[model samples]
Target: MSSDALLHTPLHALHLELGARMVPFAGYSMPVQYPKGLMAEHLHVRAAAGLFDVSHMGQLRLEGPDAAAAFETLVPVDVLGLGLDKQRYGLLLLENGGILDDLMFVNRGEHLFVIVNGACKVADTAHIQARIGQRCAVVPIPEHGLLALQGPKAVDALARVVPGVDKLVFMTGAAFDWNGAALYITRSGYTGEDGFEISVPGPWAESLARALLAQPEVLPIGLGARNSLRLEAGLCLYGNDIDTTTTPVEAGLNWALQKVRRTGGARAGGFAGADKVLAQLDGGAPVQRKRVGLVALERVPVREHTALQSTDGQAIGEVTSGLLAPSVDKPIAMAYVRTEFAAPGTRLNAIVRGKPVPMEVVTMPFTPPRYHRG
Candidate 1:
């Protein structure tokens, strides 16, 4: 697509004013970094607070008598039992158990509010519409812009703007009035930190972003830092770490699949790809490869698509996402390796630029997550 056709978030002008380096991402022109660079921006978020413009992500509302039942057919999650104000992670799968997209859904009492990856939003929405539109009202809210305020000081900073917002615990959300515009604030984010994702009217986004930036602890962070933070937190990236060819179980996202969808449960095999997915769940079929975390012993950053080899030089797998984790101060990566070699402490070699770099199959979230449970 041409540059002129690129979509701009409501905060695009503010990003320019803040001296951010804008780049095209997920069909929108967004900030990749600021003058502070990726390293500093990342560390700042770990210590204080950072504001992010994630308006490009798709937001929609689903309602009707059979909304949850209709939704349960598309993804492998217990959406019907979701409590009011509670959110759950979900995976949209193909008939053969391949992943279509991963999303977050919140039960808003009478309806469900969903947030999906920007790159897959168009396809995801159409898929849902074509399959279950008649059962539920699929209302797309394009006029809203999302902003994530993340890190240790996020609550303190936001409390000054929206009093009592700190009352929300992890995976919960509620609506609040801020300067006459209704704001939906969720205690969730992609960075694996204690934070809030605020949805505001497009016209109010810039104002809200500016108000948060005015706080001493809040700074404008770009996608560069967002990626590093999430990687350190062991969170998956949409297109890179996960894609249509990967299954939720193979991607290490089985936690998102509630027991109700597994074997011997009430709603066991009604979802897409149930046969294949349930087989993997019950261990009836062998899982050839699995996602695991790797740590480089050579201080070298192992990047995505790097080949993995066993100690005896036999090819085993490939890296899906890797980086020099700022929080851990070491090179860490996520990869798909043969199941036998996926355990922690298992020795492996990453073929970086044709040279075998030593790495260990380590546990993920090199940095422990700091979500607020209460």
Candidate 2:
């Protein structure tokens, strides 16, 4: 798409003022990094706090009495069992058990608030409307903008701006007043840190961002750092690590499939691709490939689409996302290999520039998660 046709987030001007380098991403012109560069921003978030403009993400609501039940049919999760003021991770599945998108949903008493990836939001909304619009109202909240405040000290910075946020633990959320505007604050983040994602009105986004950035512990971070942070946390990027071709079971996300939605439960197997997904869950039909974490034995950084091979030069799999992880200071990657080769400590080789770079399968979250579960 042309630059003129790209969408701009509400914080565009603020990013420019902060010397950010804009890049096209998911149909929007977004900041990839600021003057401080990717490395400094990544380290800052790990040590203190980093404020991010994530307004490009989609926000919508599912209303009416059947909202939860209707939404449950599209995912393998137990949405009906999600408690009020709590959030859960879910996947929108295709009929063949492939993933359409991974999303977060919150039960807000009268309705369910959902956030989908910016690139997939349009198709996701249309899919939901076509399938379950009659059961529940699909209302898009285009007037609101989202921001993620992340890191170990994120709560300290956010609590100072929006008091009472310190009381919220991970996966919990509540409505709070910010400068008299209603802010839906969720004590959750993608970076595997103790942080909060604030949903504010478009008009209040820049003001709220400024307030949080004014704190001593908070710094404005860009997408460059955001990607590295989530990679280190082992969180999958929708299109990169997962897509319509990947199933939740193959992606190491079986835990998101609740027992109630599985076979033999009170409410079992009413979701899309239930037969295939449930079969995988029960080991009736095993998956051919599985996603696993890899760390390069050599210092060379492996990149996406690099072919994975056995020690004897037999092609085995391919990488989906890889980088020299700033936090771990090592080359790490996420890849899909044959199920037999998915175990931790399994040795493999990445074909880089005609030479084999030795790599080993390891447990994910290269850096341990520090979520405030209390």
Name the top TM-score candidate: 2
State residue 13's C-alpha deviation in candidate 1, in Å: 0.5
The per-residue C-alpha lDDT of model 2 at residue 176 equals 99
In candidate 1, what are the lDDT values of residues 1-374, reduced to their tens digit? 77799999999999999999999999999999999999999999999999999999999999898999999999988998899899888998889899899999999988899999999999999999989999999999999999999999999999999998999999999999999999999999988899999999999999999999999999899999999899888999988888888888788888888887785767877999988887887899788899998999999999999999999999999999998989899999999999999999999999988999999998887888999999
User: What lDDT is reached at residue 154 by model 1?
Assistant: 100
Off by over 4 Å in 1: none
TM-score to true structure, per model: 0.99, 0.99
Roughly what TM-score does model 2 have, to 2 decimal places?
Answer: 0.99
Candidate 2 weakest ten by summed lDDT: 258-267
